[model samples]
Target chain A: MTVTMGKALTAALRDAMREDDTVLMFGEDVGPLGGVFRVTDGLAAEFGEDRCFDTPLAESGIVGLAVGMAMNGFRPVVEMQFDAFAYPAFEQIASHVAKMRNRTRGAVGLPMVIRVPYAGGIGGVEHHSDSSEAYYAHTPGLKVVTPSTVADAYSLLREAIADPDPVVFMEPKKLYWAKDEVSLPVRTEPFGRAVVRVPGSDATLLAYGPAVPVALEAASAAAAEGLSLEVVDLRTLVPFDDATVAASVRKTGRCVVVAEASGFAGVSAEIVARVQERCFHSLAAPVLRVAGWDVPFPPPVLEKYQLPGVDRVLDAVDRLQFDDAPDPRFLAVSP
Target chain B: MTTQAEHRMPAVLPGGVPPADALLPSAEPVRFLDDDGGPAPGDAHGRYERPSTELLRRAYDAMVLGRRFDAQATALTKQGRLAVYPSSRGQEAGEIGAVLALRETDWLFPTYRDTMALIARGIDPVEALTLLRGSWHCGYDPMATRTAPQCTPLATHAPHAVGVAYAARRRGEDTVALVLIGDGGTSEGDFHEALNFAAVFHVPVVFLVQNNGFAISVPVSRQTAAPSLAHKGVGYGVRGERVDGNDPLAMLAVLTDAVESARAGGGPVLVEAHTYRVEPHTNADDDGRYRDHDEVAAWKRRDPIARLEAHLRSAGELTDDDVAAAGAAAEAFAADVRKRLSEEPVGDPAELFAHVFATPTPQLREQAAWLAEELAR
Candidate 1:
């Protein structure tokens, strides 16, 4: 069935709730208003306010409450109205929910999901457009999942909901309206698996969430120049699919990881490290990373430049193209 | 806002003789069950019952077990098995009494100091130790046991309890969420938020504030200008009550009523379990710097466990043999727990990287790899 990423997520949640009475969804504006992004639209009406409802304007309260509910045999899915709004809730995520399972000696499991609408393309204010996945990914006991396509949005979300641990589900706000033809009967995929979008032998472009489209566009641009560029969409950030990323890097002999998070300590850093470890000898050049600037996500006017775009991916490819040809520049930098 | 000076009225001392409305807001403490094991009528709220032999026996058992667990955990910390331990020695009845009154399915969100409550809620004693050992983020499975992880930050877990109760009420589940916080926690924003939310939603939660009078170095007098912690609940529009935390029967009666009210969907209730912490906040804190010895001595006279023991003996529920056996069992249990904790292996540092995510992010993998290499060198 064809559906937008938002529609697919909503449908997936609807299906999950239908299948499991234990599943519940709550957040600000999620009940009567269907969430700010309408991701939870019609859910409260269908599931009844008991299963899906609005909460107070407190993010930490939302996540903390969900932790308690999950402890009580309920699978709670909490939504932070926007990425920026999730900061207040970070304390609960880090201090309590994330560590509950291990702290409780594996006796307590937090079967909860925190859905965050992240990234910029919609002229959102600073707080609305930021990508803070790195913060959560850095945290222990949280499973971070971000889907690029509708199929992934449907499948991975279902998997996240079913997982016995807490999951931080990041939905790219930019791609909310982006449509794709998704097959009916959504299949659940294991967390930390990457999907190969386009296959090529020259170089590999690894990206996830909204950046997948940019990587694909870069691959197309590279193809026109007689450059075979492979595109990889990382469906999950935590428990990352290192084997797939390493294999792609080994096959292409060069790779660039693209993400909307800042370059410093971002998800791309992990991709680079894995490629270096598994595909070190096969590399034609050092693995490149195309990411947002270290600064906070820029305002709408400058966000285009601040975020990693197709041009940045191509630039990374341009730098990697000279790996086989040793030049004066390499020797000059050796000293 | 009232100035701090204006609120510095000396705490009205409880008279040597029990008052008519001691537990009520206007009175000091209504001692239905006195320290001398004599029966007295409760405040206008209700009359006191001469508890049955079985109930008194159970109360004694709970206190002994709570004390044993607290002692074991303290020993574990001293032996370097746990990172830190907060002794719940003198505060046993304040926690155990309320916890024992809870229904099996009722939720509990306890603070770091409420180790006894966790023990009462069926968490493996060793697992609770594991949390203090800092080997895991949560020491127990909250989902399976209806108890949340020990909240280190003060009062943060209170709102969670309220929220859970709210959710339970929405789902038509007759479950009550009980949250334990310290006097210090009442100063935090989350505390006020939780109370306000509970009042607004009429969530079926019981906010049990164990007012041990000191939050780390700060005394209760410095924490707020309100006459009492129970009065703070009035601002939230919830029914508030103060019980002599040292009186186990009083705590049980109040907590039972609160739990039942929550279960019946009546609304939230705030209970200020007035007690004192005989020991320092934790092994790391020093009470000498902040508190007076005279104050400690005064509170010791009202020891909850000792009073309950006196009551049980007077009621003929507890025999000398029963008391001796309970003491021996508690001591043996504590020794066994200490031995097992000493034998438990120290967790691998790399395990820190595990469980953050179901799948490690590439970046975390890289950092973990880097740490592994660095450690190898």
Candidate 2:
């Protein structure tokens, strides 16, 4: 049946709660309000309040309490409410939730999933529209995943829930309503693996979460101009699938990372650096990145210029400096 | 110890001058025992009794050992053994009282200044000193001891304790979590969140705030404007209580009541132990620059050990034999700790990678191997 990513996510939460009696879900406006995005709709009513519920509007408390709950027998799934809203809990995330299991010498297992509704293009104002994945992805002991498709959203979230460690499930706020054909209990690509969504060889676009669709669009746009571009969707940010990324980079000999977060010290920077490390000899030109400017998120009206999109990807592609590779037919004819 | 109650001669209310409002929960901390080893007329005080002779005797031993543990840890920091040590010297009554009040299954969460609580709870001193030794990981196994690591971050562990207690309740475990924070920690947002969560969920958690007068160099006055640290909980719907932190009997009695009430699903309680930090916040701090030496001297006059010992002696429950035995035990513990800490630290580069996750990720393995190669060179 056709399903939107939001429905798929709700279905995934329902399935995980059904499969495990110990799974507990709670956060700001998650129970009766069904989450600010309605992603947790009908959960508290369907499952008992104990299984799914709302929490006090304290972000640090939500994450810290989840860590303590995980230490006990419960596997807690915490909704971060919004991207910037998760910042209040960043201390707990970086200090305790990220370091608890490791600091305890494996005596405890943090079977916890912190769901962050992240990225932009949703017209969210101020703190609502932020791509804060870099903050979590940089922290060790956390598995960060951002699914771009309805099927992957359902599958990756379940896998994240099933894992015995903490996972930062970054949900693209814009993709919640994007529809696709997905079967329930569907098994898809495991986390930490990248897939080539649109295959070509001239240049490769590496993206995760919200930028995946843009990268695909850039690839299709490049195709009409006779420039073969391959789009590699990095569903998982940390523990990035170097094998897939390196193979594509080796074949294409060029890579452009796309992300909506600030460019400095971001996921895009990490990807570009890693690509250089793994495929340095195969590169025809320097790896490039198309990311949000290193400035505070602009107002909602002007956010379109700040958030990475197909135009920025194309701009970054234009910088690939692939002088050796044949130029696009349109560029050749114009010159 | 002197049998005469001359130590607190200044505080003696000879005119039968009952404290202004003994019936009401006074702004003053409740004291069940006077400085001279005599009862403080429990009729006017809140719900409390002089504990049994045997319990008080045991409590005396534990307090002495805890004091000795603090002294040794402090000396270790001076000796360059521990990276840093936050002593709980004057706050032993609250630390030991908080730990001894717990059942074996109940969890205890502590902050950096709470090494005494861990030692009093029967955790090995060397193991408890792990984090303070500059190791990357918390020294002890939290699961085995049913205790969370002694957190260094201000007020962060409070929420964890509440969470653990809440989870235990859902799992049908008759458990309550005792959390230890300082007066300075009351200013933190986590402190409020933990109490608020506990009160709203009706979780079994007892918050023990050791009002030790200071957080580093900052005084409690600078940290909070509430009537008292305990009163901070009242805003969260938590029943807040205060005890004479220097009085072992009061400390143990109040914490016991709080823990038992929590175990019975009576929800959360915030117990403020009105005490003072006898020493600097840490070995590295220049506490002298922040406070007058006379202030420290005054708190020492009401030393928890001397007063508790005098009280026990007056009751005829403590003898020279008990005193000698306790002294010998503390000395032995201190000696063993010195020996353990004096040893050179060994480097196991592999251990750095071992606990980063349940199983080392591929990236960590690669980094560990690279380190191994560098070390071999």
Candidate 3:
């Protein structure tokens, strides 16, 4: 069946609720209003209000409620209305929700999922579009995941809700309506693992969330220009799938990390730093990153210029020097 | 020139509703034992149990031990053994008395000033102060003690307590959480948020606010215009009440009722204890600068320990030997704390990164390794 990201996410929520009675969906306007995006549409009607409900316009309270609910053996998947809007709960998230399990010395563990509609592309007003995966990624106890495809949306969210820890489930707001040919109850790649979207030996383009499609497009466009490119979509931001990244970068000997967040202390910066440390000897050039400019997310019209796009990504890949010709052992498949 | 009826038209709501009742505080703080050595007014059916000889003895002993713990920890800070210590000296009755009302299954979330409460809840005095020692994040296992780490951030733990109480209720467990905050904690947004959520959810929790006159240097008058801090709970639909924090019997009775009623599905209660912070905010602070010495002297005159001793003697419930023995036990406990605190804490660079998670992530592992290498060199 062909389905949009919202439909796929709803299917996942439906399946999770139908499968487990303990699983609940709640947030501001998530109940009768079906959430502002309607991703949680029809959930309250089907499962009843207690299972899917609305909360006060208090982000800290919503997140804190989930933390408490998780402590009592409920798997709560709560939504933070928007990317920038989730800042009100930053303390509750960082100080308590993320640290409770560790503070209790693992005697108690939390199974809570925080769903944040993130990244730019939709012409939203201020405090709506921000690629906030970096904040959660930097946090130690949090498991951060974002799905670029519909299949992964169902599977990763399912797994995230089931995991015995807190997860920041970043749903790329731009991809919410993007349809993909996929079916439910089908096995998808596990969460926290990266998938090589396209295989090439020239340069490895690493991206996650909204930038995955841009990376793939850049690779497709780059291939037309006679330059092969390998694209790795890091589905999970934390638990970073370093081995997969290292293998791809080591094979290609050149890397470029792409993300929508700014270059200063971003998710890409960490990925690039990791690649530099592990694949330093195999590098033909410095690992470059294509990211947002170091400025606050601008108005809708300027966001296009602010965010990293396909053209910008290809520019970085084009800059990677392929001067060594054969790249020595580039063509050799490892046994 | 306007008639009374014409003047009242705009004042009337669309539905002709009466104006909102002023959010006045509960007029009288709950009191059981009297400072003048007798019961105060307002006991119907005489249903409330009299403070038993055994109960008075236990309360007296705990207060003495709690006071000694505060004095020793304060002295240790002066000697640079402890980084700093927030004393609950004047407010020991409210802290220890209320915490003693909780069961082992109930959770007690306290602020830094309530080290006395943590100790009374069966945590080792040294372990309770570990977070304040500037060495560890928190010392004891919360699961084992059923007590959260003494929260340094004001009012932050209020939500956690409510959440835990709600969670336990969801699990069909018979438990309630009692959160202790100072008067200043009520000014924090988290305090309002937590109380609001707790009341809306009808969670099994009790908020114990020790109105100890000052938060650092901010007095109640400067903090809010509310009649009492308890009155803030009225805005959140909570059962706001006040207790004479200096009266151990009153504090115990009020807290016990709040905790038990909550476990019985009575919803949340916000109890404001009218007390005083007899000491400085911490060893580093100068309480003298913020308030008058005359005020501290006056509050000391109403010292909880001395009042309780007088009540016990007047009632023929305790002998001179009993009070002396309690003092000796408290001294012995202080000696134990000093000895335990003098021993050096084993510093392992690895433990710094440990317990950040149940299983450390790759980034944490990498950072830990870098620290290890740096320490080795």
Tell me the lDDT of model 3 at B185: 86
Task: Write the residue-wise lDDT of candidate 3 on A1-335 in tens digits.
Answer: 89998888998999999999999898899988888888899999998877887776788878877876776668999999999989988888888778877665565678899999999999988888888888888877889999998888889999888888899999999999999898776557775589999999999999998999999999999999998999999998877898899999999999999999888898889988889999999999888889999888889988899888899998787667666444332357663
Ten-residue stretch with the least lDDT total in model 2 chain A:
A326-335
Error of 3 at B225 (Å): 1.4
lDDT of 2 by residue, B208-280 (tens): 9999999899999999887888887767767778888998888888889889988976678889998999898
Provide the overall lDDT of each model, using Cα atoms, as 2-decimal numbers: 0.80, 0.86, 0.82
**Interface RMSD score of each model:** 8.0, 10.0, 9.2
Write candidate 1's Cα lDDT for A38-108 as tens digits: 99989988988777877668888788778767766689998999999999888788887787666665566
- Stretches of candidate 1 off by over 4 Å are A183-185, A188-190, A321-335, B1-30, B33-54, B68-83, B118-130, B133-146, B159-173, B196-201, B309-377
Candidate 1 TM-score, true structure as reference: 0.85
Which scores greater on TM-score, model 1 or model 2?
Answer: 2
Tell me the lDDT of candidate 3.
0.82
Displacement of residue B192 (Cα, Å) in model 1 is 4.0
- The candidate 3 chain A region of ten consecutive residues with least summed lDDT is A322-331
Candidate 2: lDDT of A302? 93
Best by lDDT: 2
Estimate, for each residue in B205-318, the C-alpha lDDT of model 3 and write its tens digit. Answer: 999999999988888888889778888876776777788889877777777777887888767888899889888888888777789999888888878888888888887888
- What fraction of the correct interface contacts does each predicted structure contain? 0.47, 0.75, 0.44
Residue A294 of model 2: what lDDT? 88
Better of 1 and 3 by DockQ: 3
Using Cα atoms, each model's DockQ against the true complex is 0.24, 0.48, 0.30
